[model samples]
Target: MRIKVSLYARRGEVLDYNHCYELAREIRRAIKTVDPEILSDEASRLYTFSRIMVKNRSFELCRDGMKLLTSQLYFFFSSLSKNICDSLIDGFVELRRLNAGGISFEVSKIEVIKESKITGNEKLVTLSPINFRDRSCEDADFEEKFTEKLTKELIRRYTIIYGSNFDGDVRFKVLKCKSVAIRVGGKKYRAHLMVFNAHGSKKLIEIGYKSGFGTMTDCGFGMVKKAKRI
Candidate 1:
């Protein structure tokens, strides 16, 4: 079966879509410019995907609606000033805040994600190493020795990719699946393995960290499971 991929905008049969689509495009651009730092730092904001999605569909007639919706959404960063970077950070923080506050779904399990790819420098790292010590017919003249060297390169390359954000055309899978969470100060935290309903596409994510202490992932969802929402 062939898959059809078309970017969706508020076009086609939708009238008065220019404003909505323009807003939507801008929001997406802003998010793309902000999420990397926001995700890595694990911050919090006073926003929600529903709100963002709504604003992205803003209109002149619905101007009041947009403002009302956004007003409830706080800039969950350190301050209320709006910048592209700040907006993304705030959005990221807000998403986590809801998830931690029992304002979202109750995820009972997750699968740790893994990604591995051999390209560029990593490919060089996976090559046959230059024999140095003794160029004899015993130590460096066997297929096993070559295989071992290749394996070592593969390990090093994977290690670097896992830690750094240098993923180039790399794909992911469930890596040694587990059902546990992590903690930093005194709260519980875990990354979400987000799977969209469309095609079951997934990405390992750690959205929430902590609450009342300015977005963090240290606090687990178990603490905010409705029974503790106050």
Candidate 2:
């Protein structure tokens, strides 16, 4: 399940460039608000989110960061568990106010995004960059490691959700990719923003679609959308 959250803020509010961590922290705070137990449950943390998107090219670049010329921005969040999504919605509604990167905003609305049908083969594009553990794009074995890590992570998530081992094969091929640098906890990490083909078990693909790909998804990495064919 997924939801789009719209936030309204005053114009001229400036957001820092390294706002992902703050954004993620605010999301966790919301989740904790409604269901404190969810924070303690490891399985409940299997989720991903997109970067903050300014509406209508409403922001301009400045020395500090993006200066909001408009009053609204939004982001998408997804998870395999309906309980998590429900908790998030309730949390957001109850909290009302959100603070990210030193900027304050009000939660104006929340809407559920309909799921797409998953097949054995699907083209996916990242909404948030994909991060493989201890791997960067510059590594000679990056692609190989990416596939290996992705497969194991999906199976791990499956086991946690189903309480059984996943015996299916997982296949991913990057069609187009580029490196992205991001900071979390004052440490810089290299990730990838890419369009890729995912081919394997439909259940696994669906899991990846809902929960996201690669590692550190809960920290807002590897969120993906079904790619449209041109």
Candidate 3:
């Protein structure tokens, strides 16, 4: 299931680019309010059960801070189960405030764009800048190790969510990876904007679409979306 939400800030309000974590927090808060049990377990909390995206209307830099000028924001949520999707939809409706950086907005509208299962042998995935790290050994080959780590992480997440072992070989090739910086909790971290081709089980790929890729998905990192062929 996939849902698109349109949000409108209260009059005279603005937002910042670094509000990704704040937006994710509001999403989780809303989901927990509707169905607290969804996050009761460690596995559930870690499971990439849903993926999100926040689209700003426009952006600007100012002395006060970076400002998002447009009143409207769009959010996309994707998952396998319609029930989970429905819960999120209801949660947004019941939400009192969509606050980010102390700024609040109202849910102007919500729409379900895709509710059915997504199936495809190959997919083009674009990842929101990912923080790929190797804390064990700083001397290791970063790119090679990062690729291996991400592959394992995806398989592990898929197994946990589906409750079935996916033995199929999951293959990924980074078509593009460029260094980028992201801010969270007032600290900046080096990350990468990656575009890749994934060839494997369609089900597994779809799971990544909803759950996110790499790590810190809940905090708005590693968000994945299908890319169109040019």
Candidate 4:
């Protein structure tokens, strides 16, 4: 399931570009309120979130960060588990305030985003980007390695969630991509923002859509949405 969270941020509030770490912390706090057990188990967090989608005006970058000339900020959150989504909604509604990287926001609305059916072949665009390599690693055949690792991870996560093996083959082709850097937990890492096509088991694709692709999804990486066209 996916949800669009609408937040009201007053003008003059600044948002750091690398605010994913802070946002993840606050989101976990909200989830902990409704489902403490989920937070306790690291394996239980099969979820990811998109970058803050700003609206209503423009912004100027300053020494501090992206200063808000806007009043509304939105983001999408998705989970493979319905229980997690339900708890997140309830927790956010109860608290109604969110603070990330020293920027304060009031929860304006939370709406469920209806998911479209996956027909086993889909064009996807990343909402938060994807990363699966160690910061020190370099390879000449990085793209091949990326596909191999993604397939293995998808099957692994599928097994964990459904408690069954996925014998179907998984395939991914990057139509276009660009390298990007993000900071998580105060550490910088390389990631990719891309448009890609994934074809294979519908369940596997659904898992990627609902949870995420690649690694560090729990820290707000690898959230994707189906694109009508690239």
Best by TM-score: 2
**Residues 127-201 of candidate 4: C-alpha lDDT, one tens digit per residue:** 997986543124556667777888888888888887889898668887777777888887888988888889888
User: How does each model score on lDDT?
Assistant: 0.23, 0.87, 0.64, 0.83
lDDT tens readout by residue for model 1, 17-114? 12222322333344445454543432222112211122244323342222222212111111111343345444433432222211221122112112
Candidate 1 local distance difference test against the native: 0.23
lDDT of candidate 3 over 42-143, digit per residue (tens): 455552322222354365666544465566666666555566667777888898458765567778898988533446544455445666754322334554
TM-scores of the models, in the order given:
0.16, 0.93, 0.78, 0.91
Better of 1 and 2 by TM-score: 2
Question: How accurate locally is residue 226 in candidate 3, as Cα lDDT from 0 to 100?
Answer: 68
Rank candidates, TM-score, best first.
Answer: 2, 4, 3, 1
Candidates in descending lDDT order: 2, 4, 3, 1
Candidate 3 TM-score, true structure as reference = 0.78
lDDT by residue (1-230, candidate 2, tens digit) is: 98999989889989877677888998898888876778687688889998887899789999988999999899999998888888889999999988886688899999998988889999999989988646766677777778888989999999998999989967888788888788998998888888999998999889889998988898889999999989
Assess the local accuracy of residue 113 in candidate 1 as a C-alpha lDDT between 0 and 100.
Answer: 19
Best by lDDT, which number? 2
Candidate 1 C-alpha error for residue 48, in Å = 1.8
Q: Report the CA-based lDDT of candidate 4 relative to the real structure.
A: 0.83
- Model 4, poorest ten-residue lDDT window? 133-142
**Between candidates 1 and 4, the lDDT winner:** 4
